[model samples]
Target: MTEQVVTGGGRRGASSAVERVVATVREGVKTGRYVPGQRLVEADLMRELGVGRNALREALSRLRSDGFVQIEAHRGASIRRLTREDVAQLYELREVLEGLAARLAAQRIGETDHRQRLVAALESMHEVARTAELPAYMDENIRFHRTIVELSAHPRLEELVDQLQIQTFRIQFRSAAANHDRTGMREYSVTEHQSLAEAILDGDGTRAEDLMRRHLRHTRSGIMQLPDGDFA
Candidate 1:
């Protein structure tokens, strides 16, 4: 993504038509832009986004596979709803997979451009958070977490982590912005990301692994405690 673009809706970078639709829908799910179990209107979106029907269908299919959309037998695509059980299971898997990814990424990252890329991503998220631009914060959040997973050396781990991270975004975005008190969560995330980067740069696999595990545990707890809706 280039420099951040501020849309009338909010701050999001420029992307392709289908990608733009996917992201708009995803954030809608995240920030209550769309409510749970809300049905998508292809005609409406096509008009709003200036895309054809095929592009909208493709985006919905992709999102359904990613666990963000659910298509009923007779009812078209609607945003997926997370039951209490669904949230618990997702958080459990996320805790384990993400911790492992971070540790593994730290095993291979050197002290150069790749590490710098992650730091930049984390800082960008921080800036968006400070500015109260939730969508940009969410975008950068995905990028920063993916940077760690991509460096982890195992392709399978990377894929699994990516899936869990999507679920994480769905939950957290549905919740609210991290509060001032939870600034600790933000600082801890940024600081650990920096430390993990250094660990990989140094090729200290053991430390990287341990830190990643701890980081995931912390994240799971922090996220769960944050105020979800009355139902959550």
Candidate 2:
């Protein structure tokens, strides 16, 4: 059953209903309230989200498109599970795409404001990491990376990165959960991000690209090292 209920009756209620239902399920998957391979029973979702069957199904469809849920004929819907091989494949593409974004961002980031935003993103990440808030930290981490992609001034590149960011975060979260030393991993993340920010700010495209690739490689290794059940 859903932990919270979102209801509808007003003029904007119908549209908002789907949005609320989607948000609930998306947040659940992100926070591990819904783990990988867990089936999302339609009736339970309808009651938990306080939405009708149609609205719940629509929400699940949206989640499925976002790579958060998988629906099969007869199997219904469940949180999408990632295999270690999936992790490797995703990271291989991420390293190339993100490395390119970082390089372009280094070349295009001439404005002081953009540089400051990168710094601010890193600062927010540090604050959340220090508090040991994994979800918040993950949000900030993605923000930091997305900011770089935005500053890259490559619209196509940003679109591509956006496509993979969510799934990548899903795997990363599970890996951190499986790791014995999450605190240490978080600390390591902060340091690496700070360094990447500095590299980009310094206008070193080559260094920025290399740093991004290396950082993603490390993340890939971390995820691959986790046991099978972590992502299951």
Candidate 3:
């Protein structure tokens, strides 16, 4: 018995359905609610989401395009399994995207609103870090990076960054969930992220980009170094 909340219909509801389904599935993937290479049967998903086959498949199709799920000829849609190569490729692309975002953010970051958002986000991360809340730290980790990308003030950049983040997240989430040394990682990441916020606030895009690229590089290397199934 899957409990799904479905309300509204027609034009307005259509867009909302897609977002709701995507968020639900993304959360499941991030938290290991669905395992790596988990086969998603349409019928089972329909029941689980309390949505029709069409809506469920639409969501799956979007995720497929996003690289979160792969649609193979015979295997259908399954969660993507990240190889070392995939991890390398994901971080490589992320470094470029984040670097560009930071560059753009430096010139465009005059708005107090964006600054406030970043400050608030960093404070939330500090609170979680003090409590040693790994889950909270991880969630804030995502928010912090995304907030920097959002500062680019370019819709297209924002769009591309969102997709790239999703692709990178699949690998990171899987590895971190299983890594035994991840608690220490949380602390390290918290400090690095706080520095990133300060850099952005200083309006030094170059430094921000440098910090982001360095962070991505270090993270990718560390995750790759971890023993298989040792990423908790």
Q: Which candidate is the best by TM-score?
A: 3
Alpha-carbon local distance difference test for all models: 0.68, 0.82, 0.76
Model 2: weakest 10-residue lDDT segment is: 1-10
The number of clashing residue pairs in each candidate reads: 0, 0, 6
Query: lDDT (0-100) at residue 211 of candidate 2?
Result: 94
TM-score of each: 0.66, 0.76, 0.80
Candidate with more favorable, higher TM-score: 1 or 2: 2
Cα RMSD, each candidate: 8.9, 6.6, 6.0
Report the C-alpha lDDT of model 1 over 122-187, residue by residue, as the tens digit: 667667667755556657667777787776667998877766676567566544365555455456
User: Ten residues in a row with the worst lDDT in model 3?
Assistant: 1-10
Tens-place lDDT per residue, model 3, 1-232, is 1233433335356666677778887777866677667888877776776777667778889988787788889778887766677778878988998888887776667885887877888888888777855566667778878888888888887887777776566567545666678667677888888787788889988998999899999888777875665322
Error of 2 at 228 (Å): 1.9
Pairs of residues at least 3 apart in sequence or in different chains that clash in candidate 3: 178-231, 178-232, 179-230, 179-231, 179-232, 180-232
lDDT of 2 at 25: 74
For lDDT, candidate 2 versus 3, the one ahead is 2
Where's the lowest-lDDT run of ten residues in candidate 1?
A: 6-15
In model 3, how large is the Cα lDDT of residue 51?
A: 76
Q: Rank the candidates by TM-score, best first.
A: 3, 2, 1
- In terms of lDDT, which candidate is strongest? 2
